[model samples]
Structure formats: structure tokens, C-alpha cells
Target: MDEKFLRKKSFALPKVNPFIHDLQLSMKDKLQILVMSFTLAPIRLFLIFILLIFAWLIAFISTLGLDIDSKKPVRSWRRLPILLLQPIMRAVFFCMGVIWIEQKGLPASRKEAFIYVIAPHSTFYDAVPCAIIATTVVAKQDLISAPFIGTLLKTLQPVLVVRHDPDSRKKTIQEIHRRASSQNEWPQIIVFPEGTCTNGKALITFKAGAFIPGVPVQPVLIRYPNYLDTFTWTMNGPGGLTLLWYSLCQFYIRFQVEFLPVYTPSDEEIDDPKLYAENVRFLMAQALNVPCTEHTFEDCRLMSQAKSKDLPMEAGLVEFSKLSKKLGIDINEMNEMLDEFALKSRSCKDGLMGIEEFAELLCLPITEPLKELFNLYDRDGSGKLDFREYVIGMSLLSHAAVTEKSIKIAFKVFDRNGDGTVTHDELDHVLKSVFGHDFETRNIYDKIDQENKGRITFDEFYAFVKKRPEYAKLFMTYADLEQDDMPQDKIHNITQRRASHALAGSSILSNVQYSNQGANAILKEKKDE
Candidate 1:
């Protein structure tokens, strides 16, 4: 699928530059991760069995007298079974230590059918719990495969879909449109618009299918309080049964479902479901206190495949080798900085530091350059440094800050044709992302294309960046730039500036795109301890 079409405009990736919000877990929180890992709870295990038995019975009884096809009002006496059985299920939830939505938290009026959107779905519990008040759920097509549960699943009346299949998507949308338009008999449509489960720490990009019906949506945000984070599904993590057993072991599983004000789309928003969907996602993310990842559900699922092999879904942890390789830095140097970063951190024995700690990293006399490096590489502004961001940010600050090899590697990123040369088209592709202008692209090309052969090889590009003292100085900070050729007086001025620094190296910050904080100015060097 074309990304532009699938993507939501309002789902912005936050920047981690100025704010140093480290995801600090309290001592209690840290202990939760430990307890859940080691302890086995037999009490909750038994409770889950009881709940399952009751759940099956409730499902069958709840749908007994309803004309599912008939357009009946939710308040009708026919839905009495559903209403009565919901509280019984909720009692089972209480026994299982499920903390869910309160009566005061639900929409004041329950008469109207709402197209509900829920987010931060860590497990099936996110949806199953909604039955306490609402009935219908939008599930996936795979539900048909389950033999026994297939019958019980009928109670939810989920709008199951096969992702990425157009026919399935069309059918599901038509179903929703028809039912939403129907006055009676339709259960409120509950959709997990993110289309997959997450760890609840971050909001992934939303799918637009939920908004396609052009109905007002009641956005619900779900949060599972966990330290070890056994709730959300992962690629290599525990399976559903394993997760259920693990949750049973926890001291208690507490989850919250917050129903925000109903979001009625304006005429403009109705026409653009993508905008409406993303805007709703943005609102949910803000309420949940999580950042937005640029990845979609399918994107995260694919990423999880690679992570399944060896990479854990650890927060603020990146592989040292991968980081070194991407930034073209020596692994040893990156490792050294990582060691120092952990030492200076409050609780980084794990070798991970929040982006704020990294911003304040004091290996170099000037921490400004380090912060600038951090701001540049901290793409999502997650306020914390993952392995990749840490490696790139610190590698640039280390000795090979902006050498010929690094510069060449950077250029190759824009060398789309693999021609060992960067043509105007390639430069256009690159500079457009950086400056977002063709005029600047043309200007940058004219300056670097020393041969004027309509393109520039690595050699010409290197020479263009090398002679200027500004290139080296800029390398010491964030956001690199090009300069006009220097006269002898300018060269002499550069010489005087370098002399005044009285250090082994003064000019380091190169013109790679980086975040611009107070540290954007490069002043001194990273002293060798």
C-alpha cells in the first residue's frame, strides 16, 4: 500500500530535544517487573478457570432472545439478558483483579448507538472488558478458526476483518455503515483502530477503517498497569496462554478504560476519514501519556519478527554493533561512551540511559554538542535514548565525528541509483527532506558538484566539505551546512579561530541534520581521560 494513503496526518512522531522526560519507574514499579517474573500465583489461575466457565454461559444466555437482524433499541427489554449478564461477568472480573471503567466514566447517555474506538490494547482483555457496558466488538477474521470459542464469540457480534484484503475491508465497512445507519437491533460498534495490541507505553499509528462510516466516535483509551509489562503482546514474547498465566501471577492486574467526550466530525473531517482518525489517535495518545511511533500495526508486527531472534522489546536499549555500524563508528568507542553514560546515570546499571541523561552526558568538556547530537538523532522525541539513537548520537560526538568515511556513508543514503554518484535527482530527494526546497537542492548541488557534470561523486563532495573550517566546527554541533569558497583572509580567519580554541580539535560538528537545542554551538573537545 502507498504509505501516504495509509498514514494519518495528525499522528505526529514527538521530538525528544528540549524535554528530558525519562520513563522513570518507581521502586514499586521496578519490583513489579521482578515479582511477575519469578512468582507463580495459583489463586488467580483458579479464578481464570472459573471466569472462563461463567463467561461461556454468559455469552450463550446474553444472546438468547435478541433479534440480531432486527433493528431494536438498546433500551428494549430484549437486551435485558445482555444488561443483567454484564454485571455478572464484571463480578468475575473483580475476582480476577480486573480494574475497569467506573459507572461515572461511561457516557452519560446509553440510548444512542456509538461507533467506539479503543486504543493501547495490551491483550484480549482490552476488548473483552468492554462488554461490561457495551456489546459489539470489531474483531479479526481469524476468530472463525477457533473451534470451541467460535460459538461463544458470537455473543460479541464482532465485525471481523482480514487485514490488507480489499474485499474484506469493503465488506466490513459496508456492514458498519449499514448497522450504524440502522436505528434498532445494532450493537454499538467497538473498534481497535490501531488494529493490533501494544505494550501501552506508546501509541502506534492508527488505521482509518474505524472512521470510514462517518459516525461520531466515542474514543476510549485503555491502560494496563504493569511493571514487567506482561500485558501487551509482542513478537517473541509470551503467547496468549502464557500471558494469561503470567497475569495470574501478578499481585493484581489493574486496567483503566477512559471514555473521552464523543468526537463528532465536522463536515471537513467527515470527508477526510484519515484526518479524523489521526486526530482521534492524537487525542488518545495525549491522554494516555505515551508517545506516537511512526509505525503501523503491520509495521510493528514485521519489526517484531526481527526482534524475535535476539533483540528484546526493551525500552531505551539498542544493539551496540548495529548502532556502531549505522553511524560508521568504531564499536569500541561507542561502547566506551555507553559505559560512561551508564555510570553518570541515576539507574543505568542496565547500560541504558534516558535521552535526558544522554543530553547531559559529560564526556566532552562541552555537553552542548552532545545535546545537539542527541536532539538530531532523537527522531520520535521519546525523551529517552534507544540503542540506535544512542549509538548514532554518541558516535558523532566521538573521535570519528565527521571523517571522510562517515561523510561518504552519509552521501550513499541519498545515492538511490547505486551509481557511485549522487545526481541532481538524488540530491533533490535528500535535500528536499532536509530543507524541503528545490532551490536549496539546486544551490547545494551547484556548490558540491565541483565537476559540474550534473552530479557529484564522493571525491568532489568530500573536497567541497573539507577545505571549509566551518564544516568541522559545524560537525561539533547539530545541523551541518555548506559554505562559499574562502579567500586567504577567510582562511586566515579560520586559522585564528582554531588557534584560539587551544585544544587538540576545535571544529567537529558537521552538517548532518540534528536537533537544535542550547547545545547547538560547538565550543570544546571531548578530552581523553
Candidate 2:
């Protein structure tokens, strides 16, 4: 054999399954499959739809033929057929592979009579599960014209809705409420608050339309853990479906449904619909572990801190008006003065100092003199100043006779390492160097370390200083002088006045005299020796 001819030939590998590889199916492919399946394998769905129509028709015909009232459709005997129909609908859903519901928490009998707002992961698969669970005549105006499902859905007596028609939407809500109130049934009103669908990772902002009447909104958070790819259907990107054909072909995908605890709307929250919606949205977000745009703990803290100064101004106008009436000060004049103060105080340059340093710079102790100052700065009441709290506190301190320049210098000194905020550890170290001998360092540390994390936070430090007036007074007095602008006239006047007062009183001078009596006694004993 020739060397070239003897060389081995390679064979091409077989193609892998595209169904396993593709993340989301295209709309065109899904529709084609749905049409073909409906044409060929229409028996199960067709029989179910026919059975449901026959059952409803029989009820209608019996009421008419037997002279039974149409308005009062729920006669004792009529309930049997409706009860039988529920299982049929459930069977259809099971066959479709939509959901396998497992109930937890409070039992159905004891559940405080309320609305169950079902939120399934937005998908066409959601329809079947929603239909199975829904009790109070589930209706969707949008789904009235939907392909094979539309005729069946209409026959089921769903209230049709027109999205842009406000009047129609309002009517739908009223009708739903009426039905729910009259019929004692668990109406699983499936509403996608996002108003559109996306991959289950993100939740769109909830619209407040459904929650208006302050009905308890039970949030049912569903997760499709096993088959996420099979469940997603959108109108955008690779996963979306625009035409009717796309939905049916995509219906065979397997899914899991989790019904989270119901969220009840508060009576107090009814008037503020937006706020109510936000609360529900927040709860849903928390349950889902998704990020919520609603106000959080941190948000509230920030708002409180920001509005602290405005408190006096916002409350001051009314308070000052009352005080002015009682104190007999001109309300207009006080208001003008307040405005001026507010304007002058707008510069937060001196606001960067710590509360202790600011107090010291003004020669004010953390005693009764600084009570208002403490309250103004201690936003959370934890006692110590965080960086923001410290800054605001310094601003308040500076207003009490400490010049802006002096306040800035004092802040720079206190903020030793120059991190904007003086943390508890830095404050403690400074305190240890200054007043460690006054109290046992170990005991002081134990008291200040609230978390026992081996370091103090600003709140802890503040609490410690507040408890000891003597130490606070001494610290403040020393800190006041650290600032360069001790008034020259004040120092000179004090020195001169003290000298004149000492000269005027010989007794005062004698009290200051140092005695050498013991020294003289020792000298006499040495001479005798």
C-alpha cells in the first residue's frame, strides 16, 4: 500500500440533541408544533372542553326547563355539577404539566376570610394551574379571544377586560367583588402585577389597580426550580411569543408551583393605595429574595437624619407660634429670625466635628447645658454619633458660640487619622489616653462594647460619656482650647481681673502661699545632730 493511501480517514461525529441545548424556544417553532399537535392530538383537550360546555349547558337548560330562577343559580342540587366540574378542570391542568400544589400553613377552614391573590411565575403554563385553583369564576377579558383556550375560557364565565378602558376595568373589579362577597368561595384572582412577563429572575413593579379597596393581598410566590427553561414565555427577545400558535406548542413543558403565604391589606393602609401596593410589593420581594424599590430600614434612617434640622424649622414654625403667643414675642419677628438662622446655618462646613469635640470647642460640658444638643444629634438614640450624626452634632455645637473656624479645627483634631467619621475604637483610644485612670480601662471597655465585638461604636461611646458628667466636663474644657481662636480680649481681661482680685485680698494671696514649715523642722534636727 502507498504511504499516502494508507493514512487513516476521519469520520464526522453525529449531531447532539438541540432540545437539550436550547435555553428558550423561538415563537415560530412553538406555534408550528402547537398547530400540528392540535390538529393531530386534539382528543384530550377537545373532550375536556366539550364536557365543560355540556355541563354548563345542562345547568342552564335545567334552570330554564324546570322553571328554576336563573339569577339564583346556586340551588343546593346545582352545586353537585359545579363540584364535579372542578375536578375535571383540575385533571386538565395535571395532564398539561402546569403545577403540583402542596398546601402549608393555616388550614382552609380556619383561614381568616380574605382574598387570595395568586402570583404564579408569568407564563402560559400559569393559566392551567390558576384555572384549577380558582373558585369564584376566574375571568380574564384579555384571554377571551385566545385561540383554542378562548372559547373554553369564555364558557367558564370569566369577566372580559379591556386594558385601556378604565370604565371596563372598574366594572370588572366591581363584578369580581360582588361575586366574591355573595359566594363563599376562595377566588384565586391570578394577576401578573408586572402587566407583562419576563424570565423569573426579576419582578416588575406592581400596579396598584388591584389593591385599591384594601383587600388582603395574599402573595403566592411560585418557583419552577426543575424546569425554568420550559416555563418562560415573553413577547420580547428569544423567549417571547407574539402569535397564538406559539402558546399551544409551548404548553407541554413541566413546571412546579409554590404557594407562598397570603398578604392581607391593612385597614389603616386603605386610604393610601400607592403605599399599600408598595407594602405588598415589598413583602413579595422579600419572600422572593428579589430587590425591592420600596423604602427599607436604611432608607428610613437616612430620611430621619436628613430631616432632623428641618424638624425645628418644620415644627418650629408651629411651635414658635405657640411659644411666641405664650412668651409674648412677635411671631413674625421670631419667624424672620428663624429664617435668618436657617439661612446662615445652611453652610455645613463646621458640621464635620464629633459631638464631644464640638462641645469642648464651645467650652460647654455634656451636662444640662447640652441636653438639647444631645437630642438633636442622637438620631437613633443609640447615644453615640455615627459620622453623619457627629457632623450634624458639631454644627449644633458651633451654633452655640464656637466660631466656624474653631469648630473645623476641633473636628480635624478629633478625626485623628482623618477618616471623616471618628469610630468607637478611635474615640476609645483617645479617651484611654486622656481619662483612663479615672475609670478602670477594662471596665470602661466592657461598658462601651455593646456588641462585645472588642471595639466601640459611636453610639456606645456617647452612652458612656453621658453617664459620667465630671469626665465629660473636663474633656470638653480641654478640647475647647485645642481650637486656635481663643478670644484674645477674653484671655487678657481674665488675667488682669484675676491679678487685681488677688492683690485686693491678702487672704486670697495667703491661701495660694506654699508653706516650708516641715523643711525648717528637718533643718533644726540636722543642726542638733
Candidate 3:
């Protein structure tokens, strides 16, 4: 990669750090907030609390004998108190400075669309929509235990979701499908399909819960048109209390809710809920006048992980949906690779690895071949590797070629001294023995033996082999070429035959006994394959 060319090349996707929002306050804005803090904030706070207490009292009385978790919805005369609670909730929003809400396009009737999908859910301020619609919502299970808020949410008969429970997601989806497909038995359910907050500059990937039922959905767009934004709460932004304090101090907050036309799925979309979700998201994004991104909530988890490991939080925003699709790697695999990247970049800063750190990671010196490999991974040729490039390069170069059997065979081949150690000469000797070729192994031994020992241990040999998976591929290729009758496509055939031939031949591995247990396991794998 040419340094100049790489610097000029544009990335495939625009970089949008949606997990962060840096609120800039001007002198005048600060003065206004300071004045309002003593003037209107206390009165707003008091009135808001009073409204919440009254709403909670009504909700508590109405839901006294109702089964909040019932498979059936509450109906008939029992819903009278729940009906009475809506205006009081609206009153709460009024006291919080959301005096009037601007609406565009009429909301869909329940018979037409039972699911209302909302987006750009940036803060608790989004609760304004729930109060406006007076409908049930999908919420986290923990919210049901909140002091006064619990009873209020229960009155809506929400579909509460539990985190970290294996069956919770499945149940949530099934419940959504049930409610959406019912015959006017349940109130329309509201879903925030982004599943988390963003800065609202772009639309992130949407979760499929709202579309899984193959039902028509109303897309609702939210906007905070305030001149000075104190409403965005993201992973690295202001906390809820701080944003609330600032919002309460504002003279007025402008909130707009635009309901797009009800979107009914086609046959293809009905068969694939993810596609249904993407189409709806694109429509909403176009209406909101923003671009759609492949970043998902999983990226936020990665950002948190990066912060915990002392890296820049933005380092983990890898456009996860796009990269994962292109690389054919899943989040679990990417997470494991992050730990390895953390180990290599600990001595570096800005969550990037320079040439020195790259060399250290591979247990090699800055030779031409090593630098060539490093440059291959440094996509932008900034002379450094970010976590995204590191993961792509490593998955492409190492994941397929490095396996448990290959590690053992390579370790056994390289440990030529029989004292369970390999010097530089032994590494070269094993390369020649296995591949009938010589490789430049200069300084590899000294680098692997960090304590300055002349020879490297088996663990060191194994680690080196893992980091350089291309060497394992080379060994396997030579073994395959040696036995032309062996099936080249079968991995176990190559590994099994290599171990047998190396042990039986009059060569470096002749005296070494390849484990029978390992051989039997390989045989079993071959049979299973």
C-alpha cells in the first residue's frame, strides 16, 4: 500500500460516532441556564413530581386486580382508570417544558396497524411519545420495579423484556407477534427498534421484533428542534439527571412526531423479517432526511469493552453490520479477537498499533517480510492498525489456517532439540524438513524468548505458530503435495497423513512419537466429516 494513495482513498462508509454527543454551551446559554436553575427548575420539578404521584395513584388503583403478565389484554370497564391517567401524564410533560407537541400525518388506527415503530430514541425525553399515544410499549424488565414509575408502566400492560435470559428475546418476539396478530384484543404496541439511543444524525440498524409478525407498522419519527440541544443522552454523553436538569431549565423544548404512511409487508418481506425491517428503516430514514448506517447496538457493547481496556471508545465503532457481513465473521469471534488486539496494543496509544507494536505481537523483528505483513494489515498505511483493520486482516490471514491440530504438529516439528525447546537453527531445520525449502528465521528465536534465553519453549513455539498461521498453511500444503493420492480438499487427510509420514520417515521427526490419542481423534473427525 502506497502511503500517499492510502491517505487519499475514501472509506466505504462515512464515519459516524453515534455513541457520543459533545454538548457545547455558549456564554449566553450558560447564563440562561444558571438563571433558570433558581427560577423555574424547582417549580417544574415540583409540579412534575405531583403529576407523577397522581398518575401513579390512578394506575395503582386501576391495576389492583389486573394481571400485568396476562396473555390476554385488559378490556371493558376495568380500563376506565387507565383512560383517565393519560391527560395527567401529558400534564407531566407540560410541566417539563414540552408544552405542545407538533404532529404530522394522522396516527394509524389499531385495526390498520398494531405496531408503532419509533426511532432516534436519544433520551428519556422520548417518553413524551408514550404519553401522547397512551399505548402499551416494549420495555426492559427492570423498569417494572421503579418506585412510582413501575405502577404507571404496568397500567399500560407492556411487554417487558429481561436481559441476559436466553428465552427472553424469543418470548418478546412471540408476544409481539401475538399482540400484532390479535383480533382487536390488545392495544397497539410501541417499539423502539434501534434498541438503544443515538445522536440522531443517522439511522442505525433496526432490530426485527416489530416486523417479525409480518404486520403493517406505522413509522414514527422523533425530532428535538431546540436551538441548543441538552436532550441527547448517549454512551459517552451527559447522564440522564444532567440532561434533565438542563432540559428543565430551558424556556421551552420543541418536540415533533411525524407518522409516516402505514407500511404493509410484501410477500418477500413477510418471509424475511430482517428485510422488512430494513425497508421500513430506509423509508423512515429518507423521511427523516438522514442516511442509514450499518452500526448496531452491538457496536456500543464493543465501545464499552474498548473503554474498559484503556482504548479510545470510538476505536470499537467498526460499522459492525457491514464489516461482519463482508468478513463472514460473527460478533462472538470479533469479541475474542478484541482481547488479542488489546494485548498487542497495550504499549501503544489511541487504540492503534504501530510497526513496533505489530512486530512485538508476532514475536519477530522488523525484517522486510515482517514489515510486508504489517503493511498488509495497515489498510490506510497511516503506519498503524486500528481495531477494525486488525480484525479483518487477522480473520482473513489466521482464523482458517490456525487450528488445534496444526499447532501441535508444527510445535512437534519445530522442537528439534528434544529438550522441548527450539533455537533459530531448529526452526529453519524444521521448515526445510517439512516444506523442502528454507525460510529466513533470523532473530526469531531471540525475539520469542523474551527473557534472553538462547532457545524458545514449546509454549513460545505454539504462540509463534498461532500468530503466523500462514506458516501452518505452508506446512499443510507441502504435506498435501507429498502424497498426491491423498484428497487435497479433506483437512483431516492432510493432517493425519502428515503425522504418520513424519513419524515413520528417516527425518527430523523420526524419533518423535506422535500421540496415538491425537491420531485416533483425527480418524474420528475424518469419519464424521
- Measured by lDDT, the strongest candidate is 3
| Weakest 10 consecutive residues of candidate 3 by summed lDDT | 503-512
* Order of candidate numbers by TM-score, starting with the best: 3, 1, 2
In terms of TM-score, which candidate is strongest?
Answer: 3
| Model 1 weakest 10-residue run by lDDT | 520-529
Counting clashing residue pairs in each candidate, in order, gives 22, 10, 0
Clashing pairs in 2: 31-245, 139-158, 141-160, 141-161, 216-265, 218-262, 218-263, 234-240, 384-458, 384-459
lDDT of 2 by residue, 17-82 (tens): 111113555676556566757663355456546766665564454333332112223445645554
lDDT by residue (tens digit), candidate 1, 70-99: 334445553555565566566656555575
For model 1, the superposed segments whose C-alpha errors exceed 4 Å read 1-40, 58-84, 99-104, 108-113, 225-228, 304-529
lDDT of 3 by residue, 1-529 (tens): 2333222333354666777899999999899999999999999999988888888888988888887789888887768988888788789889888989998988898988899999988887788877777679998899989987788888899998985565998899999998877775798988999988999988999988889899999999999988998989998888889999999999999999998899999999999999999999999999888888888888998888888888888878887887787667777877877877888886677889988877667654454545655676677668989998787666544444355776666565566456777777777764444323433555566656777777888687667666666555445444333333435345434443443333222111122222454345445555566
Assess every candidate by TM-score.
0.51, 0.40, 0.80
Sort the predicted structures by lDDT, highest score first.
3, 1, 2
